[model samples]
Target: MERLTIDDMKSIELEIMDEIDRVCQAHGVQYFLGYGSLLGAVRHGGFIPWDDDMGIIMMRDQYELLMANFNEWRTTERFKLVSYRDKSSIYQFAKIVDTTTVIFENFVGKKAATGVWVDVFPLEHFSEQQGPALLKQHQRTGLLRSFAVADPSVGTNAFVKLVKRIVCPFVKNKDLYELAERLDRIALRMNAADSASTLVIDVLGEGKLEKMFSKDLLEPIRIPFEDREYFAPSGFEEYLSIQYGDWRTPPAENARPVHVMEAYRL
Candidate 1:
């Protein structure tokens, strides 16, 4: 097997995005390019030069609709949608994976394996009053996630390393998987439509509570992405400004980091 180069990774990601676009359009399910993927679309017109992944988000309703019809809509021979409901899937979120390729990341452990993929996030409704409860739930989920993956090499600092070493011995992978299911339920319950704010609950590791935005911001608008156009939040500028102040400016080369993953074309 040969490792994929940056160009190869980008090519595969574009394929995944195209398929997602096709399914969402056919079903009238709205989705928006988000996070770093949005940043790249607006600034670089594609994946950021150093970015290796893509992300798209849909509101809870659209997300659920997509999941309900996923098997019928998805190209089974080419891609598969993996979500928390799948026993081998570790993340609470969903991923659209290319079946004829392989992309392995250490954080996913052994049970789950998928090829080059794009992350599909659900924007959960949230409210200011729910902050404390959300934080507590996130903490528990975060701990379970860490235990499930349990890579001692993850941290560089002594304090972080020591904490992982201490906790690693006590948590079993099976227990972690079971706890993740409970966390998923809690997350689903928190997504009340009456709330004024919204968050991507599966992105808890990114301090998502602070990343929350007004539900009004979710109204979709089309924007250019790579040579094609895709939807983004109508208030994307406001959302981006909050998540990354002065998002128009490119980061320093050294500051532009991509997650570590090994990819190969089948």
Candidate 2:
């Protein structure tokens, strides 16, 4: 079996993203290329030379509709949708995975099953006035996101793995998602149009910049990516600034993003 190189993985992810674009467009579901994916569109017009991951953000109702009618919208046999609702999933967000390939990841002392995929996230909202509470919530979200992974052998080092084995075992798999659902209830708002600002997945972002923007910039705009146009946040300049300050400038070689994962044909 031949290993899937970075280029190979990128090709798969792009195809999956394109499918997502098609499905959302056909159904009139609005979404925005998010996090590093959005940054790539704004800065590079494609994958950021070193980044392999893809992510998109949708408003509350839009995501619910897509998930509810996922099967009907999914036109390709190569893709399968999974979310925290699934027993094997650790993420609170949804993913559209390429069924014919697999990806094995080990990073920052964690390991889990993923695949050639594009991440789908809801546009989360909170009251800007509640600064202390929002900070604490994000800290909790990042912690729970890790715990949701539920991998017993979750570390690259012996000491970390030993500690994780002791901790991750205590939480029952079903209980993890239950906790996530509880956090979902804590969401103060969901509709982007009504929100003062919007945030995507915190743990999955590049920097801890703010997603808050005046509602005007919340509308979607078309931008070039991979020689094609895709929808990005209308306040994209501010959006990118929130995710990555000075995002227009490319990072130095050593500072560029890197993913410690491998993909292969299954």
Candidate 3:
């Protein structure tokens, strides 16, 4: 593995997409482009030149099948599947596991924190029998409410997981984002690392690292390196007002920067 520049990252993104497509096609598992990948298709007819992650949706059964054959897929290109389920702790607010990102960081021998990696979000569809129909329906209502609202009464954490499994598909990039923020807030408040990590897992499950710090705050637009393009959470421009103040781009001094990769062991 080598340190991936934006160009290198994009090239890798295509290869990963092809691998997922091939595997899903072979298994009869249905998947859809998610997050930046889907947004790219809609906004740029491809990846946002600066975007560096990839995500997809599949039912739990399909995810099981994919995990079962993960070893076979590993040979496709030296990639690794990273999931927080494997490592959730009360000690840390959050963590991202990246087979490729960790390797890339080491190869580059750089000290900067790097979040460059791919994420696979599992899509869990819900029916009235399984989850609150209103919450599921709320996804289509307002993006903000759909994302930030959480039911604190559900104690097992199973309920929230069920919500994520079901509701993520119906939302847009903006909505997807709002949902992430809301979940993060609930997790932090309840100290429910299990549920919180599971939620974050959806965003960066397969080795890519994206932040899930404050669910209330929106992530900033990021330009990882010189000559590379800029990327932000989907529809970042729309939420800039509430997140960073006035919608107009802020001065560099007032803006927060997106964290990338940091070469170190957990």
Full-model lDDT for every candidate: 0.74, 0.69, 0.40
Which residue pairs clash in candidate 1?
A: 45-226
- In candidate 3, what residue range of length 10 has the lowest lDDT sum? 88-97
Arrange candidates by TM-score, descending. Answer: 1, 2, 3
lDDT of 2 by residue, 1-266 (tens): 45899989888888888888898899899988988899888778888888988888776668788877776679987887876566445555678898888777754223346668888876554444554364466567656656556465656679877877776655435365665554554442333323544444332232132544444566888888896778888888887786667999998999876677778888
Supply the TM-score for candidate 1: 0.89
Residue runs of model 3 more than 4 Å from their true location after superposition: 73-77, 84-116, 127-259, 262-266
Weakest lDDT window of 10 consecutive positions for candidate 2: 200-209
Residue 212 of model 1: what lDDT?
68
| TM-score result, candidate 2 | 0.81
Maximum-lDDT candidate? 1
lDDT of 1 at 89: 61
- Which 10 consecutive residues of model 1 have the lowest summed lDDT? 198-207
Alpha-carbon runs more than 4 Å astray in model 2: 108-111, 128-135, 144-174, 188-209
